[model samples]
Target: MKRKMAMSKVPGYLVEVDHWNNEKEHTVLLAENSLLICKYDFVMLRCERIQRIPLNCIDRICHGEFTFPQKSLNKREGEGLRIIWDRLREPTFLSRWNPFSGDFPFCTFTKHPVLEANDKFTKMCALDQFMDQLTQAVQRAHEKKPIPGNANRVPVLKHPILIETYVGLMSFIGNQNKLGFCLARGNMGF
Candidate 1:
């Protein structure tokens, strides 16, 4: 049998694909801010993992830094960064299995899963650099809505449930799409 070759769009520029093949894990590349494209082969075994995320959909990134109180002789501390998508929907079963409903931690950006598992100091540096690059890219990509100075001129409704119910009913009758129904929910319920 033969093996297929994998290559990035740009050889030495725009895209820089990374490869890590060890006893612990294997990944062909970590492209953009939200994908871990993996490729591996062993004798008769072959596998590839692909995760494509739309960066425009990300709402923000969180950098968590904290320390735990010392129950022993020394205090334990850890730091990490996470990618917070504006929408909860994800393509993979791995992500779908662990939904980020604000109640749970978002898709982590810290220590590339493969690196974190190795427990090396390089993990910290890698995560820090990744966070910085991701943050910059997100800021540049995300567009902010400008608030009108006279925004207060518009009337504010005290009761919004009536409007919400009306939309929901209309969507039900019209058989609206997922996005339409989502809006009708008013709070993105489920």
Candidate 2:
């Protein structure tokens, strides 16, 4: 079988859900002020950043095992991190199906199962270090957000992972079709 491949995360699973619900490979760009998600453009041979989350807007940074609703078809089980900046709002059935909806308030990341058995990916993996740096940066940025008079009342960044899911839909088929861990070409002219 021909193995399909994309940019691989060495530590654990790091799957990013696209707007269409397809699992896509992304490079995590850790910048001083914002985190950027970059996608590799095969033709350009360079990663293009497609999304940005400002550090100060981060209201929470959490780590835990993924928890999905029982009916979710694409339930993923593994320890992961979730970054949230905005408040989560309940989705209406109509809004849930909207293809052009705005971005979700949070991003979820977990260790890739494929890397679990690969020794080459283990020895030097520094996800913990990365998280430490990120947490510090977020904390510093978070501290700067409170107004002058209410320093003590500023909301502390919550460390608990809160999942906001509406049964995985389009991504279910896409995940099933992935070539190995990366997204794959579909049989019908994918």
Best by TM-score: 2
Clashes of 2: 5
Query: Which sections of candidate 1 miss by over 4 Å?
Result: 1-47, 66-77, 87-105, 112-125, 143-190
TM-score of 1: 0.36
What is candidate 1's lDDT per residue for 26-124, written digit by digit as tens?
Answer: 332333433342333332255543444444445555566422223322221245444545334544544333322223223432233334444453443
What local lDDT score does residue 129 receive in model 1, on the 0 to 100 scale? 60
lDDT per residue (tens digit) for residues 49-111 in model 2: 467887777766676655655565566554556666665554466655565564467676644
> After superposition, which runs of candidate 2 have C-alpha atoms over 4 Å from their true positions?
1-13, 18-22, 42-44, 88-95, 99-102, 117-120, 123-129, 143-169, 179-190
Q: Which candidate leads in lDDT?
A: 2
Output the lDDT of residue 58, model 2. Answer: 71
